[model samples]
Target: MPRSWVDGLEARARASLPAPVHEYVAHGAGAGTSRDEAAAAWRDVRFLPHVLHDVTDVGLATEVLGTRLETPVGVAPTSLQRAVHPDGELAMARATAAAGGLMVVSSNAGSTFADIAATGVAWWLQVYLPSDRTLALPLLERAVAAGARAVVLTVDTPVVGSWEPAGDRVWDVVDPAFTRVNFDEGHDTQPGAEKALDLGPHDLDWLAERTGLPVVAKGVLRADDARRCVQAGAAAVWVSNHGGRQLDRAVAPARALPAIVRELADDDAEVYVDGGLGSGTDVLAALGLGADAAFLGRLPLWALVEGEHGVGRLQDRIRAELVEAMRLAGCRRVADARDVVGSPAPV
Candidate 1:
């Protein structure tokens, strides 16, 4: 009901969550420059509203990778949802299904892949391949067995990036051992998270060749990088700077769209984006710039604070806001979003 659903959600989260949990969800990588840049880039997009078009019957339904989604926004994989709420990833899946969108389950999920799939949420697994490829295959196989439709291979963190999570009250209570439950109970941290996979630029082709499921490369920000991924047989290229968690001075995923879109315009793989997108307007901006889908990373943390209900409410409100944006722009469909273009149209 508020003018900005995210503002109220953020306020509530700040008031309720401990300082450390809040910091983990809020702060970006070193100096927080890219985090700021990503949000600003969306503000730079301006829709070309057609005052004459009839938008009385606007539509948001769209399809991606041969699957239907009610809206183009998706839930991105975030680690340690257990640290935020009891339901965590399952709650996120339920909310996403309810919202008619997809959820990319994190490799560090507190729940197992089969368990998340059981919620009837069409989910893809976000995998961080360790230095050893052998350890990665079983995880992929397990995800497919559990009905994962795609594998969102997270390539930004070949090795974990450094960031000191804020506050100490969390560590004083929450076990450092409790974050990961998707793997062996004895494996306290994510198994393959720390080492490089020795992956060639074309190595993704090798991985995709072995799997029955589609392999989507996430964390790409350059058109050249995106082009290489397409050549590597990536089913999709997700434009992300790891939500600005890895690199400090990186470009925002939304700002990188024009170049990446141009490179992959003729390619089969769709371009997905994430980082600093917290509202439907932000989602609309990404769509207008040619992103097939936009993933909400930090916003979901606010939703997960109240479990699935919060997520559902946030999602419902976002779709509503998207419809409003379409109506004001005099756009009748998702495809119309592209009409906005990179530069403002002639006055």
Candidate 2:
């Protein structure tokens, strides 16, 4: 079989980047079981494609939180892009815009929201509230002023996960200027600047009320948690395990998606997911499993290793692959992507 686009990009990125840099992007918490399992779980989902359907034109367009996307696949928030490439988030924003996909800017992004938004990409801000919730206000205010269409509140990392073996070396060597440039100078030294350990459902309400932008609760795995987020004023619930970086042995998004979708069956909230989703079929599987949209975490960063063009190329290829998969599965539109996966089984 030919090398997949993601595999090819990973190989090239690994070859071009320093070992530590590559390892940082690839590392998962603890035993790496969650990261390994995330990718494997999606493959276990068997596609139950319909027969004899006219799939001449497979539509990939979909609206996410009122923002229209030419493709259902979007780039997830990954930090320190400049650590791998000079252009950093700017390059990603440009490429994602060129491909007409959404880009989620990380709280720790190397570039300013103004610069990223200036790239003309439809973007959302992914945030981790600080112990002093007020610290996030300026950050949220800036992103909204920069034209962020939504806010993805990442609630998984009450504390950053422990990446054993690699430890702090993954981040210790990165220049401080290349990460979290959005915060005030010496922000880390301030009291309550650390990630809030007391994050709760009410925090979601606070963010929505404060920003006025639709809030998407990310890092949700449990159906109960997902339901609570919507109940707390979240416009959407993103099923994720922080790409297996935050919590080791957490349930993969692919495995946890069905439960969350069922939990929010009656609510008018959109469900998004990301984690080890690397192919068109993987995306198709996610949509078929009731996801409003599937996001890519690592692949875009790996593609960004070659700059904006690489990311754009990666998007084009994935879109093509998704179209083919949808056509084969008799999915003429994003909504029609449902009921294509077989009955759930243990992964």
Candidate 3:
């Protein structure tokens, strides 16, 4: 078989990147056990192929927090896109816009909120709240002003530590002009940001009251925490392990999905999962398991690094793969994905 788009992207990215850049994207905290397992969780879950069903067309479009996207293959927030490529999230944003997909901008994103938002794609702001709420509020303000449709509050990285051996390569490669415009010291202070983020349940409600945009709590890995997020005013729960970057041993998001879906079955909140989701089949499987959408992070970054054409190419390949998977499984829409889910694929 021809090398999959995923396989090619990884090859080109690894070949193009230096040691430190490679470590930055690939490494996990501590021993990296959870990082290794993240992909396996999805790989183990397979579809029970359905036959003799019409699949002339597949409806890839879905809505998240009111934003309609061509497909659920959203771009997860990866900070310092400039560190990876000169255009950073700007290129990714434009690509997403061209394809009518969604891109979530990180608080630490190298591109300015306005620059990313200017692409005209539906974008969400991913905030890693500083220990001081005062420092975080302006960022939220800027996001709203810049046309962000939703605010994704990353609750996992309160005080994440890094173990990338060549972490400094990012600083070496990124331009000094590169900065997160929303949190510039002139706009938001940097004091106390190094400490754990001080946000709590009440803060979520406070945010909801202050910002009209939907508040989504990212990094939740448990059902109770997810429910608490809903109680605290989060419109949705983003089930993630920070790609195993924050905590070394955190459970895979896929492994934790069922409970969250079961527990919040009655709640109004939508649940999304985003660890090691790389293939269209994985996206289809996620939908089968009850995820509103599957978010793609590293692959898109690699695509952007390969230049503009790569971005659209990778996304197109993923959608095509999903369509193929859906055809084999007799799924023609997001709702049909669940119908094809079967027991875990044999290891």
Which predicted model would earn the best TM-score?
A: 2
**Cα lDDT of all candidates, in order?**
0.80, 0.90, 0.81
Residue range with the least summed lDDT across 10 consecutive positions in model 3: 187-196
Q: What's the lDDT for candidate 2? A: 0.90
lDDT (C-alpha) at residue 174 in model 3: 62
Candidates by TM-score, descending order: 2, 3, 1
lDDT of each residue in 24-138, candidate 2, tens digit only: 8998999889999998888888888988999987789999999999999999999879988999999999999988899999989999989998889999999999999998888
Collision count for each candidate, in order: 0, 0, 0
Q: Give per-residue lDDT, candidate 1, residue 23.
A: 78
Q: Could you estimate the TM-score for every candidate?
A: 0.93, 0.97, 0.94
Report the candidate with higher TM-score, 1 versus 3: 3
Clashing pairs in 1: none
| Candidate 1 lDDT score at position 295 | 89
Question: Of the candidates shown, which would achieve the greatest lDDT relative to the real structure?
Answer: 2
